[model samples]
Target: MGHKLRLLWAAYRKIVYVYLLLVLLPACALLYVYFHKASAELERQVAESMLRAVEQVRINVDYRLSIVLEVSDSLILNELLYDNLAEPASGYRFDQVMEQRNLASLIKSLKGHDILGIKLYVPDDKLYAREHVHFFGLSEARAQPWYGDVMARSGAAYWVSTRPQLYGAAGEVQALSLARLIRDPQRFERVIGIMEILVPETNYAPILSGAEFADDAEAMYILDRAGRIVSHSGASRIGERLLPQPQFAEMTSGRSGILRFAHRGEPYLAIYDTLQQNGWKTVSFVPARAISRPDWATSFASPLVLILSFLLLFILAAFLVFAYVTDGMVARLRQITSRLRLRGAETVGERIANRRGVILRLEQSVAHMLTTHEQLVADHYETRMKEREAQLRALQAQINPHFLYNALDTINWMALTRGASDISRMLNTLAQYFRLTLSKGRDLVTVEDELNLARAYLDIQQHRFDNFTFELELDPAVRECRIPKLTVQPLVENAVLHGIQRKEGHTGRLLVHAYASGAGYAIRVRDDGAGMPAEQAERLTSGLQGAPGPAPAGYGLYNVMERLRIYTHGRCRMQLDSAPDVGTTVTIFVDRLPER
Candidate 1:
């Protein structure tokens, strides 16, 4: 593994090198290999097809030669002919003369129509060499170039690639012929005469023409067992031996198959097969370039190479730009991280950002922490405010749990000490007062109803105190909001009992009003009667509990303040303003969002 890493770095140390090493290079190599393999495969297939084509021609050529062999076979078995032709004729007689001359004509008239010439050669004095007439004596037969191999073939015939010009027909480029020895039938080992059959080499041309391969640039040829070129695309190379070439070495090694070899510095594909019956072989040869990458292939590949090169360069450039940008970003991130550590941001962002692999998410974490801190602080202050309001609520408490029993005990003691008549009178007054204030035990009343109560009380008091006048003003919009039943009535009663009733003359004026304040409502009790100074009014409105002075005078003002503080959760306030010869206004203000 260590070695592999080192090798990788060595090969791909730079971005461009890495791209070339891993991507472009492999692709180019694969393309090059694929092109060659595809060409080779195509050539192999075409070569096999051409092999089949040549094999077919070999078959037809063999079939045509079989006809001559048949005629030769019949005459070779004739004992009477062998007996007469074995010895030179003593004199020309009608029987011997006709037999010798008619022998050539008889073989020529055989069933095979493609057979163009047939020659008979016998060692007899009566015959002279007349090659055109197809009758040759011993001198003509012994003078032929292929006379040795033909004589050596005992029973089987020898196929000649080219016949001597003396024995060829007119206009023949190459004459394919068969030469055979006529052995005495009884003593078949003794040679008596020779028979040669001739035909134009073009007899096999149709086989190649019908195939789908080139007949000009590429070639197919046949070689006999003697390694003689029996048939070729052109006849000039008929007698040449291609079997000795290094290219044909592998072809001769096996009965059939294909091989690749170089010719004239160019590669070629050759497929070969042997004629099983005759030991002859046919080879089909094709240039490798013709099958693999043709002329059009090179033309098309030029543009493709340019496009691939451009794409490779573009990719390399993109990688370089990315590296440069990310490097700068990493440096900036390191600086930010260093600053954050020194400033002590709780490093919560670092943990979160590290998990997600992003620095911006670190900022999100910091923001989240700040928001959480703010929320905690708000909650802390809210709790303290709630505690303060709870203390105020305690001040709003009225009767204690043991007050009723304690009061009954005090009444029993009072009955013992005072007269029964005095105790009975006090009980009756308290009972009537409680019944009027309870109002069937309901705790809440609309401002309109409460104002009506204040007006009714003032109506009764007006007869007792003829010196006072009272006015009631209530906003219809504020009348729908409910408050404690006695909230506005007591304030009005304080104005009447203390301020308006105590005034010296009939100049005392009382105003009881309620109006909208924010989302809640406000009630004001103003009296234009004789009012006290600010210090005296503050003394009266100071407080009911924890007082260093005497008990508070205005129970009505004290009760309203306590109720507003408790019910509104310290959201409401009551202020009393009074000056010498000036009116005193008591206002109970509420905010929109009530604690309840």
Candidate 2:
């Protein structure tokens, strides 16, 4: 008995030391993984919060700028302004004064809560008026860049800087101006004068400042076409150029959305949005530290405390096992082993048979754990796929063909009344094109159906252009190949209008062909007009494929690419090739539809 007790003590001491060493390493490794995961989770949460806050700021800024543009459009297209510009300068001079007074009253009415000041520029007299008073001489007005740009564009509205001459003496020097040419209705060919509006920075400050986030977050700003700050929460930074360095300049050129940059020695997360209509950019910034900071002690301390408690329980359990099961079982087991060795090998076999029941129970427990792990993995993957599908559907829902159709109809009617038959016919064709576009009930349509729609569009365009010609060559085998609806029409239209119309005296040729390639079908549209430069073509493709929302090129191509990606599981192919003055070709390839 004394020898057995001494042997048990020595064995127990060695087992306890080994167990502690084994448990300690795992416990430390677990601690490291726990903290590392917690830090990563913290960073993701911060980035998401910052993105949401900056997005809200972007919405507010867009709303404000939209209001400004709307007001500017209303003033430029005002009947009184148009009537005043129409009449000859000699007999209609007094009439112009009365009209100007009425316009001033209208401006005051429209200015109820938003506008800071209004101005009108007459190129002939070099005369300019703001809030009912003539301010600049003809020579002085002509010298201004805003006047030159308004003349250069002929009639389209443009945004400009509000200097002291046009804006009120008390008004802010750095204000936004909207200018458009006032054309005569009779001829519809002459520019009579320019109309301008000076919008105060204070009106936009609220938009820049109202961006809300956690206390640690910062607001965003907008850079004008020249890269000068137009709107910002920080007043001092307004009008200063932010992208003076080559790196920032490169970053700003045609790039949009969330980016990281260091400013004034602090790292910041910036969300940038470029306004396609105005060539202006809005950027919001939050401190990187603010976005990535984690309360490590708070987030990880609870888990660590639980782990420590678990270790305590494990230690107590080990001690209990040592006192109860180990002390008794190991002693008995050793005695049995010694007896078997001294006597015969048959006793050893009998002892091993008795332990089979315990080993069987352990096997069942391990199998159950494996089954649970596999189920968890499958559930995670299913959840992720569903989330991605939902996002794609949401994006598809936002493409509104109705608004585009309405805008086209308006342009068509305006052109018809003005006797610009070519422009009117083009607008009508565009309207008909989109009408069919909205009619396709399904998001996906056959390649044959899409090509027929493109042909209908081209027929109308051909009537409008008179000299432009096009041909289609489709492989009968691939005609029924599935593709997104209205995909090819816009590219064809771009080729006709931008490529063909701008070229010198020569017949324009547009060729569209489709054929089978491997397991997919390839559709190509090539034009023999003034082809785009390589850089411009790159920009067009990048914008179509990469932008988050509807790109300005046309919602059709963007929608098509997105749908193809979803349907083909990223197997669809899109390519663009073009050379200046040669031509442009756009190709799309997708999986062939299964036979009916």
Question: Which candidate has the top score in lDDT?
Answer: 2
Candidate 1 lDDT over residue span 1-596, tens digit each = 78965764564469657666777777777667755564455555555555555555555555555555556655554444465676656566675667665665565556266666677787656544444466778667888877998877775778776543444435444677778887764466777778777766677655544542553442777777656676776666777876556555567788888787787788776767776446777676667666544433543365457657666777767655555555597876788889888988866556422121122322343464466456556655654455444433333332222343356557756775776855554444443333334444345556676777676667656755667788889887786676766677677766776666566764688888888888787888899866787777777666533232343336656766666655566677777888766667888787643333
lDDT of each: 0.63, 0.65
lDDT of 2 by residue, 366-475 (tens): 45445545654665455445445545544544444544666788888899899999888677666766666655346566777778779879888787667888898889
Model 1 worst lDDT run, 10 consecutive residues: 352-361
Q: Assess candidate 1 and give its lDDT.
A: 0.63
Q: Which candidate is the best by TM-score?
A: 2
